[model samples]
Structures are given as structure tokens and as C-alpha cells.
Target: MNRKQIAVVTGAHSGLGKEFVKLLTEDGTISEIWAIARNKEKLDQLISEFGNRVRVFSLDLSDRTSFSVIEKLFLEERIHITYLINNAGFAKFCSYDDITVDESLNMIDLNVSAVVALGLICIPYMKKGSHIINIASQASFFPLPYQNIYSSTKAFVSNYTRALNVELKNKGITAIAVCPGWMKTGLFDRGTIGADRATNNFSGMVTPDVVAAKALSDAKKGKDISIYGLPVKLTWLFSKVTPPKLMMRIWLMQQGIKP
Candidate 1:
């Protein structure tokens, strides 16, 4: 059987991941999408909406073994991968001392390790015009006090993405790191735990659809960074020019974290 071209998307159940699924489905070059996430029920719902073009995998990306499944699929099917969207990541907002060691490590495992592993695994299958979009955060632009571990993982993502872009340029594969600000997703509540949700509520939320739309367009153009919103663009600029200490101070003040 001649298998169809594939697009692999992680975190495919909701928010940006869901939007990415929709965008990829519209691309006629890719006929099958392998959607990976831990939420089987949500995956089923997404599959219901998109039909057989969506193949759901209920696996946790945080586990090192999970990535092996992807390699196995590629080797067995011998299909070309046109897009690899590494969108599965999470952030726990709170002070360092307050967060447990296990919690911090899990963030690193999901937000950093899994992303790196998948990038290494997928690049061999992807060729010119193929795109890999890694979901980073604007929080990565500076050292965030309350969101320390999460933001640090994102910084690694941003730096690694740029390096990967340059390396892949010769091969015609484009790798982009998308650093978006707060969005209207369920994760917003997770981030505000033990902190005042109202503190950062002033910035406003960007719809995941907008972020997904802009990212897909930017990825096709071979852009290194894809960011949404004027506020987030300005924040990225501020983080670059301002000193680390000043950026931390500003973040703390904005998040209602005391000195």
C-alpha cells in the first residue's frame, strides 16, 4: 500500500495544537496526520471532527520511550514527513523554592528534552520545504522570577531553534521557534496557581487561532521566529536591550511578586 505523506503534531487535543491540526489538514500535500497527546478522549473528539485523516496516539511525550514509537512508525511505513510540529509542553508558575524538584524536572523533560529528541528524530524524514515549529514562549526572552524553570526551558528552545535553523538551511528544511505570550487556553489557569491570576490579566489574551495562523505562515517563509501581538513583540525587544536584572525586576513587579 502506498501510504500518504504525513504531518506529525504533538499536543493535538486543544488550543494551539488543535489549530495546527486544522491548518495542516488544509494542506493538500499531506494526507495523514499523526496526532500525539496523552488525552485519549480529547484526541478522539478531534479525530471525530477531522475524520480518518487524523491518527491519534495516546502517549506521553515526557517519557523518553515515547519518541521511539515515532521512529518505528517512520521505518515501518516509509512515508515522507512534510511537517513536524512539536507543540507538547507545559509550564508551572510559582517560586523556585515552592516548586518541588520533581515538578521542575518534569517541566524540563517535557518542554526541553522531548522537543530536542523529536527534532533529532524527525529531521531525517523531513526534506526541503518541510517545516518544524517548536512552541516556545515570550517568557523565554528574559529570566522570569516566578516562572523560572519553565522560562529557562523556553530559552533553551529559542537558542536551540536558531542553531537548528542554520544547520538545516542547507538541507532546505526550515525550523522555527514560536514565542507567544499568554493565550486563552486552559493552561492559563495552571500558570496562575498560588499566584494572583489578576496580576498578569492586564496584558490581554491572544486567541490560539491567531498564533497558529501566523506561525504556519511564518514557517512556510522560513522565518526563524514567529511571534504574535504588539505587546509580545515589544516585550521581546525589551528583554533583548534591557539588562537581566532589570528584566527580572519588571517581571516581578508585573506578576505581583515582591522583592
Candidate 2:
């Protein structure tokens, strides 16, 4: 029996993840796409929209136990994993004092831990030409004041994915860190609760579709990082030349936050 060529995407129910799923389904090389998210209803809806090509896995990536569940399936199905998109993450727009410790930790768990865990579990099933695209943010470029924990988590993701790509080169596997600007997704709905000044400025926000398209193109080119939009690209360049303290100060001022 031949192993199926499948793509595994976390947070695949909607937003950027959903766009990725839609693109993957059209990929002639991909036999199936495993859509993983916390919402079963939304996952089921994906199957309806994309047909049997989309496999639903309603698992919360933040929970460590979820890795075990995914691992078990990998063992049983013996699928050839072509792509792993670690896109399941959240952000909160508020001061550090306003965020509970649990919220901060959960952000770490889902954004950082989930990416690491999924990479370890899926790498064995992947071969050359396989891609791992982790959705980071332009926020990763700086230490945000009000969006503190979220920025920190994305920074870890951006750096970690780049380093991981370096390590995976021996196997010809490509890892891409997608750093896009503000996206008008469901993320903002939860992120803006008791929103502070940071939420006021959503500059150069793009839709998930644009980000997803560029990510796929960059992955094919074997680029280590995919940054969509000219504004976001400029931000990445700006962060590199500027000092960390200065960058933080700039960000705080841009958001009208008091440092």
C-alpha cells in the first residue's frame, strides 16, 4: 500500500489556516490535507466545503496531550507528510498588568510549544521537498508594550523556525517563517477584549488570503522566511538596523502607549 501524500495544518478551521487548506486541496501533489483545530463544527464544515480531501482533527494544539493523539495517528496511518503549517496562535491587546498569568502561559503554549511539538512529531513522516510554514507576525520584529506576550511568542516562532530550517537542510526539508502584518481575522475579536491603545492602530492590515498565497510561493522557492506586503518587509528591515530599545520605543509611541 502506498502512503498518502498529506499536508497537516493546525488552526485550519478559518483565517489563514483555512486559506492554506484551500490552496493545498488544489495542489495536485497533495492527496489529502489534515485540518486540525479546536472547533469540531468548523472542521466538519471544511470537509463539506472541500470534500473528502480535507480530513478534520479537532484537537487543541496548546494541550501537550494533543501531540500524543497526532502521533498515534501518524503511526497508524503511515502518511507521507508533505507540509506542516503551524498557524494556530492567539494574541491579546492589553497591558501586561491586565493579562492574567494563565493567558500569557496559554499564548506561549499554543504559539511556541505547539509549533515545536508538531515539528518533532511530523518530521519523521516527511521527506525531501517537505515544507514547514509557521505563521509568525510583524510583531515578532519588536518587543511590543501592550501586546507583550503575543509579540514575545511570535518572536520565538520567527527565530525558532529560521534556526530549525538551518538544521533541516541536511534532509532537504524547507522551513518557512511567515511574518505578515496585521490581519483582519477572528484573532482580533478575542485579541481586542478590554483593548488598550495598542488596538487603535491597525496599520497596513491585509487579509489572510494574500498572506497564504505568498507563503506558498516562498515555500516553493525554498525561502527561509516569507514576509508579505511591502510595509511588513520594511518593518523587518527596520528592526534589523535599529537597536532593540529604540524599536520598542518606536512601537510604544506608534500605539500611543506610555513606556
Candidate 3:
């Protein structure tokens, strides 16, 4: 019998990560899955629920030292990673005045730096048909008012993923970015800001399961970028025609926040 293809997804404990884990495990295409997250108990529960198909890896994406541990696993394990999904990130909402240097730096560390580092670390181990999917935000298409830092980080992720796709294409490694709009995940509820605002304006929000399914399907098709939801698509289109300053002003006004 042929060995099942291996897939690795970070942030597997909750939100879209959990959905991805569930979908991929049930998909007959995947043979093995490495569910990486910081929560050991949740990982254990996921493994128990999914049975022997899923392997739990206690990973904290923001930790620079964690790469070495992952590296050790890649080298020692005989599995070929068919897919890598960088889905681990946190959301912080604060105006520039209220945002601290440490908070801003942490956002960059987790959302941008760690993602790039993970891609680089996984590249050497990735086989020819391997694919990498980075979970960015629809905020990448426009400037968000209270969520400035998080939005900017996602913008960077989206751009970086596209640029990297070109470089890896010749080698048969596909890199794609998934840009999803406001998702009904615990991210906002557990965030430092924007939870109340998001709840009040939840009409356009998409479920995490929907987003994850679309992302996986897009990645499998080798799509360069996947932007989820109609409102987000319209916002992205508007950003293309509108000037940066004007767009920022309009977005802030819509959010009832000042530019």
C-alpha cells in the first residue's frame, strides 16, 4: 500500500485551524497530518477524536527557537510534507495612540516574521509537489482603523506570498495566500480590541469552516491568492481605484474611527 501524503497545519487548536484539521483528516487525499499548536491538551483531544491519522506537535510559532525543534522533527521523520499551512496568528486592535511599541512588535513577530521564517525553514524539506498556504486577512486589501498593525502585517503576508510564488513555481512548489474577511472566530472575542465592534457588525462575517474549506480548495488548485467573501472583494476592488490617503480616511470613517 502507498503511504499517505503528509500535511502540516499550524494553530490547529481552534478557529480556522481546527476546521482545516478536520477537513484535511477526512479528505482521502491526505494520509497523515501534523497538527501544530501551543495547547497540548487540545492537541491530544484532536488526536483522540481524529484517531491515529493525526500527530500532535506542540508548537509556538512566535518562538524563534521553535524552528530548531521543527527542523529536528523534519529530519528524523520519514514523512514527506505535501502541504504546509501557516495559520497561526493573533489579532490586536488599538489605535496608533493606544498601541505600544511592544504590542506592535509582537504583531510583526508573529504575523510577519514567524511566517516568513517558517516558509524558509520548511522549503528545504518540502518535496517537489509540496504547497504552502499562508493565511492572510482581507484587511490586506485596505487600511483598517483600529486594527492598523494587524492589517499591515496581513498586507505584508499577502504580498510576500505572491512574490514567493513566482520564485518557487519553477521548482514545482506552489505558494498561495488566503485572504479572508471578518471571520466569526474567537479571535475578536479574545482580542485586545475590536470584539465589541465586530459583534455589533456581524452581518457580513463568514464562519471559520467556510473560510477553511475555500482556502484548502484554492490551495489544491494552485491559486495565487484566495480572497473570501463578496464584501471583502468589493473592498479590495475599491482600494485599487481609490487613493491610499482617501481610502484610509473612508475606512476609518466607516469604522467610526478617525484617521
- Candidate that scores best on lDDT: 2
lDDT (C-alpha, whole model) for all candidates: 0.87, 0.92, 0.82
TM-score of 1: 0.95
| Superposed model 3: Cα runs more than 4 Å off | 1-4, 97-99, 194-203
lDDT of 2 at 69: 95
Q: What is candidate 1's local distance difference test score? A: 0.87
lDDT, candidate 1, 1-259, per-residue tens: 7656899999999999999999888888898999999999999998899888999999998888998887888788877788889899988776677767987898899999999999999888887888989999887898877777888999999999989999999999999999999887877666666744223544767889999999999998889999998999999888779999998887778867678
Q: What TM-scores do the predictions have? A: 0.95, 0.97, 0.91
- What lDDT is reached at residue 110 by model 1? 92
Local accuracy of candidate 3 as per-residue lDDT tens digits, 55-125: 99897777788889988887776666788889998877666656568767877888898889889988876
Clashing pairs in 1: none
Error of 1 at 217 (Å): 0.3
Q: Is candidate 2 or candidate 3 better by TM-score?
A: 2
Residue 139 local lDDT, model 3: 78
